[model samples]
Target: MIFIYIIVAILLLIGLLLLDFSLGKKNHRKNVRFLDFESTTGDYQIYTAGDPLFEDLFQDLRHAKKKIDMMFFIIKTDEISRELLEILKQKAEEGLQVRLLLDRIGSYRINSKVIKELNQSGVEFAFSEKPKFPYFFYRSQRRNHRKITIIDGDVGYIGGFNVGREYLGKDAELGNWRDYHLRLLGDIVQHLQSTFFDDWYLATGHHDEEPVPTETEGEKWIEIAATDGVQLEDVFESLICQAKEEVFIGTPYFIPSERLFKCLTDALERGVNVKVIVPMKADHPLVKEAGLPYMMRLIDAGGEVYMFDQGFYHAKVVIVDQQLCDIGTANFDRRSLFLNKEVNTIIHNPRFVMDLRLAFLKDVQDSEPLNDHLIQLFTIRTKIKIGIARFFRPLL
Candidate 1:
């Protein structure tokens, strides 16, 4: 009888272990391969400065007729946040369905009082994966690092703008903030709207009251690529492999996995022109040091690297062969390409490519080339930090 009980206990333990592994595997596979959104043509505009982006966002919110769905990584107690909160509050009061999803850890600085007021005013809000001490490693680490807005399901937004004064360059310490955002219109908006509901459903477990899907007519080649960081590795490599002439990437950080790094260097070996632009002013201090090894390796392999001096270049975009353009919230770093949830819009329109190329050139005018000499000047203490940074690249 005692032997039978022992055998039962061992089997139960094994069953529990297998269950945990299966659940983890399923969660990692949550990143769908591709969006089956209806094909449509629409006018897409790129916003590089904070002032115009903020103005356009506020206007969109005010013009919203039915619903407003917004998700962001950070929401501070800055001027912009206050203004946005006021607008969202007003909209909720006017009976427009307003849903907000924020990353709890990213927006930790947000005032509890403001959140309470918004809740009382009928602004439905919830933080994505609110951090807990026991489950900090896996659960809280995978943040909804995506920033998107679906206004009335007709207009859509994707890119890297959070509600903060730093994005407007208002903070002297961070200097002038330079970021990129996209204002999209068309049936493609419907796809993005539904994408928001996916996260909303996970956070709240009920999406019956989610924003209504809206579609429109069009004829452009725009595809939405969603990722939880694992498949993004393949998407980027495949995208780079298709480049014929040149590949230009603009990102705030550069911390890709080893395999992806080889893809770029290999492309360079084939005489393809490869250029990358990263910010001189790092929002995260250690990030600048962490990216040095990758920078040096790329430069050594005949690839070019540039440091944006105008301000913090927080734009994550890629243009391949002047024909293919991809822009969204995913950076070249491991955090965006491996750990966090991110989205990028892939467009095959020449007009859109030209627009992005022009913006890249304009930004280049404000950038200075990066070389080995600059990287070697770091003190031994900083080198120690770089070594530590390399070990924790995925976490960054």
Candidate 2:
């Protein structure tokens, strides 16, 4: 009788979760907003490694004259993040506006004591996407995966590098972190500053000051594309469909939706070269396995796939025909496509695009091709893992 009662309780819990998810999905579908900002000019500096990126970012933060706004999916309570927190505290104590926004579930490791310290120092801090009643499960699953920083309306930082020791290649397990980050200077900062304020409003329910616009321009042109859980698929689809010569994708996760998979295959059929690079190391269970089927399908369709071997490939980049590059926090997975709030920088500068392409090719050189020999090594256990991954694809 006790066993039967336990089973009944389990079923009831699962039913409740399903219902919450359904309700959240309906609400999310209704609130989907796709933003297309006007093209702006900025001078950009790209960072592939973490140490220099942090050094420059920290310097910029120290020099902020008026405001510092930062939002990230994950911020670890480690050495690097502690340093950043200290910086923000100092800035806020100096009477400068300093606000930090972090995802609720992603930055769970940051304890209350740290937050209290920041608050005491006059730093405005808020967690985005807190779970609510009637759709707790769904809200918990959706995340704000964008990483952006705006300072003084003159400079902007956007990319995939989170605040952590691992991001600085200090983790023993995941050695040598690899990612792509961009530092922009000019009128483009206004667009990203606007994004930070909008997100800040959503997270804290408080209106912030208007962005301070700069009248600077450079050769590089960019558009900041933002998606509210939905509409990202259409953005990616449009980019892929417009590919005329080749497509290069680099991401940590590669579990594409059915429609997205079809888009890739269709691109291949139309003689567009499609190449993808993903990490050989699995950061999360079932995520690597979840991408196996999709990777195999791409390989079978004459697309080239490479597994990054030097370190974890945490970059989210897509290059089309050496003319356009999309780089941001969104992964090539269902979460980024249909659930997470994501922002991507679309670059239309030929010089920058060509430079990024060369960097992509260098990483590809450091990768191993997914050929027949690698596929032949899969055992029955691997097959079972793939099945489990497919079952939990949405969560991954």
Candidate 3:
């Protein structure tokens, strides 16, 4: 018995050491740098609304002399997707290299006619890793939940908004999907392009171009961080740890990991005003049920929680102390933290931070307050369902 105990202890120590080493390497990989737009002492223009965003992106694609790459989790056959496809076809015809990567599961319902048309037009496309078995297990659950667009290594865009009518406020059933996307113009575009290439290679087994960090003659401080596999241990935790006074979070899903839950609770206890906004009518019933227990705990700890009652709230944003902001496709749920390939940009700009805070305040106005009474209104059966859902939250 004594010898067995000693062997067990030795194994545990070795496991811990391995974990620490893996975490360190993951952190190093997570550190990404881009030219800061706010700090750059140069002339820049700010564009908002779907029309402007699409216009700029199309113009870039039309004039692309080298490369155009795009990756999206979902790309419905809506007006936006049609316009994008037209532009991509035109670029391909002009002899510009155009590549598209879409998640197979998210774009499962995409119109086959549109895909066939694009293929005939000479545009190259690939779906994120296909499942080994289609009808047996939950293989499709591991999705490439990233939305990125890069053009000629000079411009890029990343955020939660997918290429669909719902994202552009056209889906009648969804009413209006509130989301956020950022257009980046600087060295960071290289990283965005590289991310797309990695996914493309994974899917098509083809190597296109390698990303080389671009040189910009301006001062801009930007960092791109992502979480996937075992690489998530520090990215989200570090952002939470750096919060000083106030933290504002907006996400569609709220099933957080254990360490993240504790960090938010601790921050609230330290007198930090922690506010979180989630969708009242979630698309996934299981996620809605799994999120309630965490909501109750947060409310009990004096943390502010809001549920957007207007439409589907799909933005993923975190503003810390009104000085730093992280905007991307990553949610606060377990899938984003541990399973999905997610990307985020950390910006240390007062202008962007202030604008993001203002947007959050606008969203808060449309959100309903969550409290204990609301949570207690569920029936016993619903409560049992919720409990079971929570048990599988991490897996979901």
Using TM-score, give the best candidate's number.
2
Which whole-number lDDT from 0 to 100 does residue 270 have in model 2? 93
- Residue 264, candidate 3: Cα error in Å is 0.7
Superposed by TM-score, candidate 3 places the C-alpha of residue 310 at a distance from the truth, in angstroms, of 2.3
Residues 85-173 of candidate 2: C-alpha lDDT, one tens digit per residue: 99999999999989999999999988899999999999999998887776889999989998999888788999999999999888888
The top-ranked prediction according to lDDT is: 2
Worst 10 residues of 1 by lDDT: 31-40
Clashes of each: 2, 0, 1
Best of the two (2, 3) by lDDT: 2
> TM-score per candidate, in order?
0.89, 0.97, 0.83
Model 2 scores a C-alpha lDDT of 0.90
Q: What is the C-alpha lDDT of each candidate?
A: 0.82, 0.90, 0.76
Q: Which stretches of candidate 3 lie above 4 Å from their native place?
A: 1-52, 111-113, 133-138, 212-218, 379-381
> For model 1, how does the per-residue alpha-carbon lDDT over 341-371 read when each residue is reduced to its tens digit?
8878888888779888988988888998888
